[model samples]
Each structure stands twice: as structure tokens, then as C-alpha cells.
Target: MDRRDYLARLAGVAGVGLAGCVTLPGSRVTGDDLPSVRNATTSNTSSPRPDGRLPRRGEVTLPVSRREMRSPLTRDHIPAIVDPVFGDDWDGLSLPDDSRAESTTLPGDAPVIGLTDGDRARAYPLRILDWHEIVNDTFGGPIAVTYCVLCGSSVVVDRVVGGSTTTFGVSGYLWRSDLVLYDRATESLWSQLLATAINGPLTGTELTIRPSSLTTWGAWSAEHPETDVLLPPPQSNTIRGREATFDYFIPKYRRDSPSVIGFGTDSNGLHPRSLVLGVAHGDAARAYPFETIRREGVVDDDVGGLPVVVTVAPGNTLVAYERRVERQTLHFSADGPSRLSAGATRWQRSTGAGVSGPQATHDLTRANDHPPMFWLGWSGFYPETSVYGEDAN
Candidate 1:
């Protein structure tokens, strides 16, 4: 389906019932007609200043660019799905038996913790939730956390009240139940329409909040005018992207016999993440000659969005490497199937050449006689494969 159709599906999933409906203005255009629409030119001349500090908002990369990075694959090229797709379909997509241990979560909150405060939110995997999709959180707030799968741009939005938070998924939208601020003196999801206002100004029950039950689900699409909002299938931070301090890393394609996969993350968590995957050569400590792949701008909708051509870097290639907590481990297609152990620190070879690169699927469940799911986001080239998300298989 096209972006609009995909969005419509998401709206349906929001379960707006009769109250969530709203009349959309103007004739809706097909995905084909999007090309006719022109987008404004944006400048990327503002980089971090020489003071060794970060740049101002004008200096940072824009959200559109990050969208491009997340989808190096063309959206128009995506085959229309006759039926809705969920994250559970991937099975036997990775190495047979990986001996790798569980990767440790960062000290604070898990970087890609699932937001269980909603009906739909609770149904998807935490890793899949990492990708920013329009979901009605249990808090009754119709918000979206635009986390790119490749660039790792995570931006939370109230979509109504305009209340939002950057980097970390924070907003006026509570995680308990899907509710609007305007009706209950909190804030309306419509307030999120304030462009660039990631976080809105309002709090408590004294504020007014509305529900889709009030005006149908028109409030969601009305607020986000740029693109058709959709719900993402379950995925992982490894596939899409994840937020890190000042860094939004994204994974693209791999290089060299599908040995390594590429990834990039953004500092803004909403723009192109400058990362790639390739074979490691020259510098043992820091993988050198790392080939880069295009993560953003792969899609076609936004005109002035992601303009740079995705290519491999000139002198270096990236390599296949895994982080087992404090100790880092390197792997090769020759290393057999990479598997993860219970401890979450050691990766072992399956003694079988299963799938290699980021596309390889590893079964995470041992109950079904299937190995755990695992894939390296960093690889060396085209035709590279890696498994993404959790699966009982």
C-alpha cells in the first residue's frame, strides 16, 4: 500500500471508534501524486562551531534528512501489502546457533525499552517500538515517537498539544492511557502541530484534553501534515536506530561477503545518522577503510529531504564486530553462525555457515528448538542480509 493507505491502516489500529473521527481538508492524493508536490530547500551549512561545542538548531540536521537515512530503500518501490504485516514473520532469518551472550542494556533506562502503557504499544516488541510510529499510548495520548530505523532519530510528540521531547521519548502524552489534554484541561494532541515545538507547555488534569472519540481520529493526521503517519511492525533498535548521548546510530547494508553491516545514528535523533558498515582493514583498534552505505534519502516522497548519494567510503571498509558488554568481539562469515548465550556477553560460532551479515536471523527462543535471533547491523556490501526483531521461533 502507499503511504496514505498505510497511514489509514494505522488510524484504524489507533481504535478511534466513532469519537476519534475528523474530516480531513482537501482531496487526499495518491502516493504517485506526491512527486508533484514540492518541498522547500533546506541548508545543512551549519555544523558544530569551532568552540568544540554543538551547533544551534539551525546548525543541526533537519528531520527530513534523517527520514531519508532511515529508509535508504525507496518507499515507492516497497510492494503494496494486501494484508497488514506484523513483526513476527521473521524466522530462521539468522545464524543457526549463535553463542553470543545477551548484550547489556545501558546503565539508566534501557535505550530501547518498550512503552507498555497502551493497547497496541504493549502488543509490539520493545525493539520494534524503538522505531518511531504513530501509536495511541495507554496514556490516551495520540502521540508519535519518530524513531528512524536506520538513523536512530527518536523524537517524541504529543501530536495534539504540541508538547514533545527530544532525544529521549518524552512528551505530555502519558503512557498509561490514550487521552487528549484539551478535554480534561491537560492539552490537546492538536497542540503538537506547533512545528519545532517538540515539547508543549501544559500539565496536570487542570488542562483540557480530547479523545478521538470526540472528533474521530482526524486530530492525528491533521496535526502531522508532512507525511502519512503509520504504525511500524515490531522491530529492534539494531534494525532501525537507537538513541545514545549526542549520537543517533543507524544500520544500513553490509560489505565483504556479507561479513559486516552498516549503521548510523543522529545526535538530534531525528536526522540522518552518519554511519556505515564494511570490512575492517588497516586500523585494528578502529575499523578503517570502512565502506559506507546510504541509510537516508533511499525513499522518494520528500523532495529536498535526503539528497546525498549513498556510497561506500573511498579508502576503508567496515567489519563484523559485536559488543559483549565491556569486552568487544569480532566475527567473520567464516566464524560460522553467530549466536547469543543466556549471560548476554559471549557470542559463539554455530559450526555451521548459516546466514551472515546484518540480515542473518537468529532465533531468540530456545523453547521451540530454534536459536536466538541475532544480526550485526554493520556489514560490508550489497546483497547483505541480517535478521531483525524478536521471534518465538
Candidate 2:
């Protein structure tokens, strides 16, 4: 079945009686239409002056030459969500469970990217994201929740530029099989994986990645029962006449045998399609594969010379955090799958919050997983990254 049909099938799993999915009307350009789009271009005159606003075009630096970028679709082929609407009662809606159940995949089991701001949990369903790649959300300050279905990359970033908040949109461009996003205000082209502007006026500027969890909606909402979910626009907006489908892409091809639009191969045996939680710190970056973490339960390791800990829940919700507390490095182990225990202190797996012990008020500094991104997506940008099981595997 096509992607839209797939989304519609999985969204049926939600137990709610009703409520949303936003899908843009435009369709991806066929291979034949690729030639119609222009190659990316830029004119660099001086060193990049990193700041909060877009500098004039031709007055700064570019980390990559324009030759590496190509426009596959015109702007808004998959539009960005500028004014996102949320519903607190979506969980209460009666979702199609047994009646329209999927024959292959589990119903309502699609991955939902979860984030909490000001103690309010929100879910951005991938079904909607497959159509609109960027959501410029203003939950707490300004942030952009982005997903590139091709690369299996979801990036939540601080959308503040040069002290002012801005929104982002899909550029309909592709680089290294990843999404290229452009800020609506300045029109600077940003790479979703690199989180850096590759062209336009704001080249070389990097976005601050925020913390989020990529997991099944059942798992996320079960933990955050009060979570608000993004609702899709009316069916009339979908140009393809595709119904309001919800859910994420299920990996079809193998990383061992690469596809035309995927990472070719890895001599290290890391498959491009492998699901992993990746962390980049200091001068080092590493990927913690789901298989390894699911088996080990808790992994205490060091990256970039700093101590780190990784925890995974039974539902595949994962979180990473700095293992040091006030300069003291503590080795962490599993207190079951969803909690961490290190001597007298304990932390919730979904969050680094100290739930029990004298440090209950202290919060562990959140570490990066890049939202359980795929191996091909993470490794493409961090080619020198180390694998967590290099020594064990």
C-alpha cells in the first residue's frame, strides 16, 4: 500500500473516539521532475558571523558549496505547520480499534515524537509529519519540530535566530537523502540532520537541538496521560484526496543492501536502517543501537571524555543523560527498564528527574539521542562516530 494508506491504517489503533492529523496537499516530485528544480546557489564574501537574525545574502560563509544541494520539490511540496493546533481531549476520542484494525501492522502503534515544555506534554504524530515536514511551534519560546521521513530523522530545535523567534518551512530540497528546511522569515536553507544552514543568507548557523522521545503513541500517552496531541486539518485540504492518516514509516529495505536514496554501506557493520539513539558531545559522537540497549537495559559509558548513561523502557522510549552529579561521576544501572538507580539516587527513565533521594530537586542535564534517529541519518553527518558495542559486539 502507499504511505497514506499505511498511515490511515495505523491511526485506527488509537482507542479514542476521534480527533486529528494534518497532511499537506502537495505530492513529492517524481524522478522525471527533478531536473526542473534549480541547483542550490550561494555567494560567500566573509566569515560567517553567527547571530540571531539573517544576514544579507552574499555577505557570509557556507560550510558546503552549493553543488552538494538540489531542489527535488518546490517550496511547500510538503508545507510546514506554522500555527499548530492541539487538543487535550484527543485521548478521550474513541479511535477505531477492532473494527478497522490493520491486517499487518498494529493499530494505533505509529511512532509519536513526544516533548514536554512547561510541564505540558505534546505529541507530534508522524502521519501528519509525512506531509508537512516542519512544525514551527511556540509552546515555550519558539521551537521547530521537524522530521525527514527519508532519513528517519526528527529534530526539535530552538527556532530563535539572533534574539528573535522565527518559523521554518520545508525547502523541497534534498542533501544526502535528508530534508532541507528554510526559515520563513530569512529564507535560509537549513539541513535537518546537520541542524545547520547550508545556504541562503544564514549559512553556517547551527540550531540548538532539544530533547524529545520517539515512541509509539500508546507508550507516550500512557506515560503522559495528560499529553496534548496535534490534530490534522480537515480532509478537504489534502490534495491527493488521501484521508486523515496517522503513523510513521515502517523501514522496508535493508541497510546491508543499500537503496538508491540511502546510505550505501558501512564497513563497520552498522546498517543504515538500524534504529539507534545517537549522542554527539565534545569532540565525540556515538550511536547506541536499540538492540544493544534493549538487551543491556542500562548502559553507562563515556563520550567525548564525559561520563554518560542511557536508559530504555519496555516500550522503546529512551533517554540519555550526563552521569555526573555536581562533578561526581556515578555509574548508573537499571531500576527496572524505565528508571535508573545509582546508589541512593534514582531518576525516571523518560526524564532525568531525581524522583527519590536527597537530590530529588536536582535534575540531570539531558543528553542527546537525536530522537531515536536511524543509523544512516546519524552516521551521514557524523561519519567519524563510534558505535557503543564496538568492543562487545
Candidate 3:
């Protein structure tokens, strides 16, 4: 079907009467409902198994029935959509040379998922991810880099599960408005936000979270010139076309949208759509609202009884690090020539490495697992989370 016809049909399905405005079934619509619109375009590019059929549900042996599987969301509410993007496993994945990348193609403000391991770094632009939500690739090691445009969640996880390295694919399912990933090895379904297998043989298994950053393409490319950026696989021109056609439909899911899923209420009174850097240390979880941090620049806080510092660097990159160095709790501030300071120590915001001071050789431990996500998704997953601000709920 043509793009216009398909979009009209999709709008009809969602009861959207206006051209640019999309309204869902509920009285209130948030970013969660925005990705659902991709369901129509997704079917056009969804990858099939090598045998030319959709992978059978429960293809892997499981102790429990598929229908009996449960997660934070109702199993019945989980819609079985078409993969539409990265079908099967690692389909359309690519490694493009950063030096060779055409900077003119990506806008400076365009979002990109940044990942680094030692000297190896890469940036996956959202323009590509808007079509394929998952990229199973190796850079210094096996890793699955994922971005759920629906939930505004970007995470990079170790591909190895239970000592066995496996690739992942989009399962064409959404749990609590988050992407559901399936391992090609066991066909086990996993939640992208929770980073845990929710069904199939590997149920309850957790994937190791890796340190990554979500920032603009210009900022990331400037920081790591040698980093390889993912480009659309030549075979997926159709997917790329669909992304362009639907570009206008994205703002409805932007930070201003009223659409939200799960616990829509923000106990801290922060806007449900506000962006925040969510930190979960042990049982303690807190959200550092970007609005406040953008104003203050740096925040010194504690999570799970461990002193920590959250810094917002130039280009709006957000990172959190443990403040304890050799068992000494050091206070930090952004008011310095280096932009970060703990006493006489100068620190680099990108690597959390001390540049100069008595602790010049020390590296601040990073709380990499903390996801910088939308307030709606973060609070939904962590209902009891505290907001880091004077007006916190």
C-alpha cells in the first residue's frame, strides 16, 4: 500500500480524525502511543526467518505455557505487531567508518546512541534507529544496542547470556509501551526497559548493562572522531524511505505530548513527559530532572546511601558517577575551568576520569546502568522513585 493510504488506515484504527494530530483510545495520549503508529509501516520491512515464515511463538522449550507468562503489564494487553524493522536477528546491521561518514547527512541536533568500551566508541543515529530499533553488533565485544523510540529509552547490553553469546531481534511486541526483544538462540522474549527475559526458556535471566550515552550526533561525533557510526544496510532502502515519509508524525510523541502509559501520575509533580536521568542504585532510585540540571549544571546527590554526582556536560550529555575515592567522600561542582571539580581535582565529564588533582590518577566509578529516559517510562518502571528537586514528590 502507498504510505499515505497506510497512514490513513492506521489513523482510522487509532481513531485519529485530524491529519497531523493522532489520538488514541484513551482520553490522554503520551509518547507511548506514538511508536504504535509505526506498526503499519513496520509490516513492510519486518524480517522473516530464513525458512520464509514468522518464528513460531514458543519455539524454545519453556517450563511454563506461553499464555501463563506474566510481567509488570497484562499479558493480554501485549499486542503482537510485526517486527517491521530489525527482523529475525541482526538484519540490516552495519558498521560505517566515522571518518568516512558524511556529516552533512546527520543534523547536529539529531539524537544518537553513543557507546564506548575503552578506546572503542560508536554512535548509532536515531534516523537509522527510527526504522530499526535494535542493532546487534560487536565493538571491542558482543553487544546489543537498542533504542525504543516509543519509550525514549536507549540501552546497550552484553549480548552474552548464561555464558553463551546470542543475537537479538525485535519481537514485534510491546510491554508497558516498551520494546520486547527476543534472543535468536533460545527464542526467549525479553523486555528492553527491564533488560530481563520475561518468557521462554530464559525467563528471569538478566542481561548485563553496559555504559553508554544518548546524545546528539554532532556532540558524539565531535567527542569520538574515530568512532564508527551505524548506517542503513544497503538492502533496507524500503525501511529508510518509510522513515522519511513518516518524519512529520514524530512530534506527537515528543516531550510535550500528554500520552503516557503505566503509572501516569508523577508523585513528584514533574511533568510526565519531562526528560530525566534515572539512577537506580540497589533498592534506591532517583530521577534527576533535566530541567533542573540544565539550570544548576551539576548535582551532588546520594542513592542507596552512596554519595554520587550527576553532571550535565556541554551538548547536554548527562552522566552519573560515584563520589567516593579511596573511601573519601569528595564534593563536586561545575564551577571550574575543567567544567568539573572535586576540591583541586579536575575531571573529564565524558570519561569520568580525573584530569588533575591529588586524585589525578583516579577514575570515578560510573553508574552506567542508570538510564537517561523520559519521566513517564522511568517512573512507570520504578513507581516508588524519588525526583531530585526541591519540588520532588
Instruction: Please tell me which predicted candidate would have the highest TM-score against the true structure.
Output: 2
lDDT of 3 by residue, 1-393 (tens): 432333234323222211112222232334343333332221112244677664332223222233332122222121211122323222234333323333335566767788787886777766656545677777766888787655578888888998988877766555545667788788777878777776666765778888788887677778777776664444233312322222211222443565433323333546545778888877888888887887787788899997889878655767888889989998988855226788888888866877888987988888647557776567556766777884642
lDDT value, candidate 3, whole model = 0.61
Model 1 reaches what TM-score against the true structure? Answer: 0.22
Ranked by lDDT, the better of candidates 1 and 3 is 3
Question: lDDT tens string, model 1, 1-393?
Answer: 432333233233221221111111133333333332134232233344478553222222222222121111222121111112333222322321331313222112122312223233222222323322223342344444333222222223443433532122212231111211122222212112122321122221021222111011122112222312122332223112322211112211221222112222212111112233222222211111111122221111111221111111111111122322223222222121233232222233211112333423332111111011111112111112221111211
- Pairwise lDDT winner, candidates 2 and 3: 2
Return the top candidate by lDDT: 2
Model 3 TM-score on a 0 to 1 scale: 0.70
What is the descending TM-score order?
Answer: 2, 3, 1
lDDT, candidates in the order shown: 0.23, 0.67, 0.61
C-alpha lDDT of candidate 1 relative to the true structure:
0.23
